[model samples]
Target chain A: GAGVSQSPSNKVTEKGKDVELRCDPISGHTALYWYRQRLGQGLEFLIYFQGNSAPDKSGLPSDRFSAERTGESVSTLTIQRTQQEDSAVYLCASSLAATVVRSSYNEQFFGPGTRLTVL
Target chain B: GIQVEQSPPDLILQEGANSTLRCNFSDSVNNLQWFHQNPWGQLINLFYIPSGTKQNGRLSATTVATERYSLLYISSSQTTDSGVYFCAVDQETSGSRLTFGEGTQLTVNP
Candidate 1:
């Protein structure tokens, strides 16, 4: 089985620029999530998508941060006017389903992540 | 919003030893999971025990939902076990989303 994959393993951009990180979830995964991890820090929730329904964008830091998923497959996290504080590794994960059952929650798989550097 | 806390922010252990990691949450959660982040920043799912116990090889985790806490245990630790372990709780408030802990940085030396 193919694992989740992200593009542009490393990205270096200037402040105020916009960056888009893409995520390709595993086949048949109905739920996708994006998280950010700063150096020496924990993973911060960004956004999540379940099936064809609207995404849960509550974790997005601000209006500048947005994400979109098409047909329960690929997802993209876009940070507009990126700031130095936005420099971090962006991670993506996917699960077969989003049910909160005791057994299903344990199966989320993750991608390698894209390290974005805002210089 | 939920708050997650992990104990012993940093730990140093010798190979072949055993260790325990703790995670506490501020409120009830529907989904509780443990993850191991390697040096390369890849998150590996360790356990998704919202309650009860689960063991995978030398690692075991238990989540006491009633107490709002979870414990991860590693026995006969190996050098490869050195990494940051995080506890994330998904409280179904608006949607199923995870709130992560600050994480516990563990270093296992051979």
Candidate 2:
């Protein structure tokens, strides 16, 4: 596909279980981002991966949340021992570069998102 | 952290009507983009207008960077345009992590 692709459009998991959501960005895009949208809420930034630089995990709600990008391509967000509050839509987006001035952040394309429901 | 606010939390318009959504940020942003989340949960980038005005079809957006406010204009409303329109901004201080508005839920009635 030409756009970002996410797996497991919907997932139901036990509160104690762990879940991993995947994001495949457009081929050759250099920047990737992960965000979460709770019910009736706006998107909250999670992490950002740019080229080989360290990922900025400032928005990660807790230590239990971690993500990694391989070769500036596929990225995965893992929630360990998921809590009910973790239930929400996990969104993935990829951009061409950092600032829109020179890089045209317009490269950022969003995926359909994976809906996780914790029971 | 910068504060972002969107007005008219909800709006209902008849097809072919025009409407505007506003987003106000507490600080200046060099990066601002408008997105539309369709009913099917797809986030479509409407415009990456950080400043000035940009138009595409029936949609147009303007961002007053110095004033810290942006507006999205939708002309000729259609059922397909019924969805949540989000305004996201990235403060250079934040390193590209977009801070999004609560969004304006627009409903177009036939």
Alpha carbon deviation, residue B87, candidate 2 (Å) = 0.2
Write model 1 residue lDDT over B1-110, tens digit each, in one string: 78999998999999999999999998888788899998888889898788899999999999989999999999999999999999998875645677889999999998
* Candidate 2 regions with alpha-carbon error over 4 angstroms: A100-103
DockQ, all models: 0.66, 0.67
Candidate 1 docking category? Answer: medium
Task: State, as a TM-score between 0 and 1, how close model 2 is to the true structure.
Answer: 0.96
Return the top candidate by lDDT.
Answer: 2
lDDT of 2 by residue, B33-55 (tens): 89999988899999988889999
Looking at candidate 2 chain B, the ten consecutive residues that score lowest on lDDT are B89-98
Worst 10 residues of 1 chain A by lDDT: A99-108
lDDT per residue for candidate 1 within A1-119, as digits (tens), equals 48999998999999999999999999998889888888898888888788756457778899999888887788888999999999899999888888656557436788999999999
| lDDT at residue B81 of model 2 (Cα atoms) | 95
